[model samples]
Target: MNYTLLNSIIVIYVGLIAYLGYLGYKHTNSTKDYLVAGGEINPFIMALSYGAAFISTSAIIGFGGAAGAFGMGLLWLTFFTIFVGIFIAFVFFGKRTRQMGQNLEATTFPDLLGKRYDSNLIRAFSSLIIFVFMPLYAGAVLIGAARFLETGLGISYITALIVFTAIITVYVTTGGLKGVMYADAFQGSIMFLGMAFLIIYTYVQLGGFTNAHVLLTDMVHLVPAKLQAIGHQGWTSMPKFGSALWWVVISTLVLGVGIGTLAQPQLAVKFMTVKSNKSLNRATLIGGIFIFSMTGVAFVVGALSNAYFFKNFGKTALEMVGGNFDKVIPLFIKTCMPEWFAYIFMLTLIAAAISTLSSLFHVMGASIGKDLYESMITKDNRGSQKQSMFLIRTGIVAGILLSLLLGYILPISIIARATAMFFGIAAATFLPMFMLGIYWKGVTRIGAISGMFTGALSSIFWLVFIHKKEAVALGISQAIFGKPFLIETFPWMVVDPIIVALPLSLAVTIAVSFFTGNTAIQPPHLKKCFEGIG
Candidate 1:
């Protein structure tokens, strides 16, 4: 792996990151500056920062490996990520969130919703949810990067986990959101250039774009027996509808993360950093391009690695990695690309990891330090600035520790699954109320509370007892009922929890809001919420 060259690269990358973090520290002068960059971040930097935070090693390594195994069907996720995650989020959600956040003087996401609904319970509970579960997503990202270092650098996975965690904890804690965004912009640029080069190099290796996919379609028979029974039609074609594979690909991988992007506290908070609706509008194109380059190239290159492996090694990508798809992309790069290119690509993955990890830790810190601590401990929504920063720093450290622990504890091939699990939970718990809170004048405090609890509890219930994948692994249902899942039926067992929980949440929010009426929020406060909307 060329230790001398690798060490040189690490020094350069870490140096750049330190400089950016210092820049972020200098820019942060207050709670607002630390949290949202004082709401004056440039559109280009915001777009890149958001895109970088959104696409981490989880997308490049975990989902990319899934593409190697699942085929081009993952492209649908790329489409949704670009369209719904960026377009709808910015056009429909961003403009309003920025204005409302500016109006309410909200810093954190929990604060944004809590202030909007005028309920401390909403703020506190939302803070707890983000603080608790965001680590799972952070852990998934950590695992992806740790595995890459383990594969590429021959470093121990635990060493990678601890070292990277420490670096990012300091980076985020000292620099705040400004530091995170500045570093993210740098990372995002590397990700773009690396991925752009990868796709071009990949197509040349596998003949041409047309021939590469044709070869994959023809290798349908190469799919294993276990996969064949489950619905392995072909790499190029969709999984057979209603099959287990189809359910997993559609519900968990595609819909779970794709739709879940909207309510992400880390990403949503980025919208509040921009100054105007026009910035959000302009950001859409840049963000779309960034996401497309990151995810699109990843899935495409991953799917094509199978062809390259089969032609030379006479095995599929999954088989080459000994059935651990998490190792697929790293192994492919190590074997196929030039040594110089391989080292460069490793930075791309590292950047993805640092960008997302820093953001996750930042959001987790705010959830606890700013939202939960202020609402629960201080009793005033506004707490001492010095004390709040102290708690936030503590939260970032604790979040990093928990995330690193999970990175070590989780099983292989868990990168994509862990990520989707957090996304699905976040979607079910927050999205219904979030969507209504920002858009609907009639949404009441009680309704928001009811909907939020229902979504959160129901999603947990489904995971613990109903969703076969989670239920079996978690063993909660097995311990209680002597069955892995409550229903072992074909479709029910495979369905993602968000599919059921989100609708129930939305239904309850709407019904409860009408039952409570617009009087739930006082006229003046409600008027303040929608003040500038036409």
Candidate 2:
């Protein structure tokens, strides 16, 4: 609403980010510095940076918008992230990953996994997956930020998309992970504080916490006939089980992201940035609080935006935004909240977006440069810095352009759905291989490769042929099978790709590993990976 104030804030924030980027550029000497922050970072900064990168605009704008449109059942996602994403990740995965990475002298996630499996093809396959799908995830975040900017600043969506991407292009290219972490710490703080205010103020506006839910519950009769047919319940209650709506919420939204977080390359890579086990333990406490303030608040507020909109303007959130779920949170903030809070919230969104985009692009660059180009293309597995830097920046620029393009063409209310799809894809492609590669010596190169391919191929096959939401949009099944999806049944059509593909990946990996256990790697190498850590 206030361009002059907003523009001023933008300048200051960009100036700080630039300075941090320069600091990172100055500190980044070796490839290790650029990729993993020289293997030492503050626990607080690492935790906050990890949380900030993990949340993104997808959590706030996209998922929050979903909450507003659908209801509060998404709260289960918050619980999952805390338990699985934060706790299981740190206690079970993070400690081992850090030591294994240090032992392998790995620079990126693909490098870590590939070295553990003693297979360059494993690295190439994993890196290819990241390079392919990470941009799509980044695109979802890209569009989420642009949507908010277009709505809050009253600009066209295309203009918002370009301007935001343009700002990110200059700095992320120069700044290494150290700079990214510093900027993330700063941005994550704003997000946490802004969201803290957001939840409190929203509740205060809608008759406190208890009354807010009551207001929403009382309006359950207002559900449209179309929604009720598919199990639309009140905001306070979960959808009726076995319904399409129930499957989407649980299978796609909650489980897809919640489980997928464990195997995310961007998040996994951060664990290696910390030097010791204690740092990760400290990080767990800070990370849990940060995640709650971001996703938990966004979902609760998004669900309750319905109550707010109805009481004030006699329309549901979907009605107010003309059925565009992505615009719900932005529209609500601009219309309902105080002008000053809008400024903070906008900064919060910008921070969340940039914090995430920078990391995603950086990870893309590393995935391509270190994992694919160096390991696969070069015989020595590492070429000159000039060549390496060239490809890394090339990956960054390419990913940025692709994400910007997706931001333009993606359909309305596609943010959260797109995010879940990316997460699920990541889960299917890498989760089984990655998890077993670290934890089990019984895992073989053949098993890891088989699992990765099976999971990735099967997941894509299911998404294109069976998953109702993505299949109908892609329409490949329509042309070949003469149907939008190959399956027209009840729950089978609605079940997530991760549910089926992940289990297949696990079973295939284990079955193959059992047969190939005698062909395992040298004991000394295996000992190196498991040394001095659980």
> lDDT for every model?
0.90, 0.89
The regions of model 1 sitting more than 4 angstroms off are 377-383, 519-523
The TM-score between candidate 2 and the true structure equals 0.98
lDDT (Cα, tens digit) per residue for candidate 1, span 147-235: 88888888898998888787777778899999999999999999999999899999888899899989988999998888889987988
Cα lDDT of model 1 overall? Answer: 0.90
Error of 2 at 90 (Å): 0.8
Distance (Å) between predicted and true CA of 163, model 1? 1.7
* Structure candidate 1, residue pairs in collision: none
State model 2's lDDT: 0.89
Model 2 residue runs over 4 Å out of place are 378-382, 519-524
Residue 122 accuracy (lDDT) in model 1:
95
Model 2, C-alpha of 89: deviation from truth (Å): 0.5
Native-to-model Cα distance after best TM-score fit, residue 82 in candidate 1, in Å? 0.8
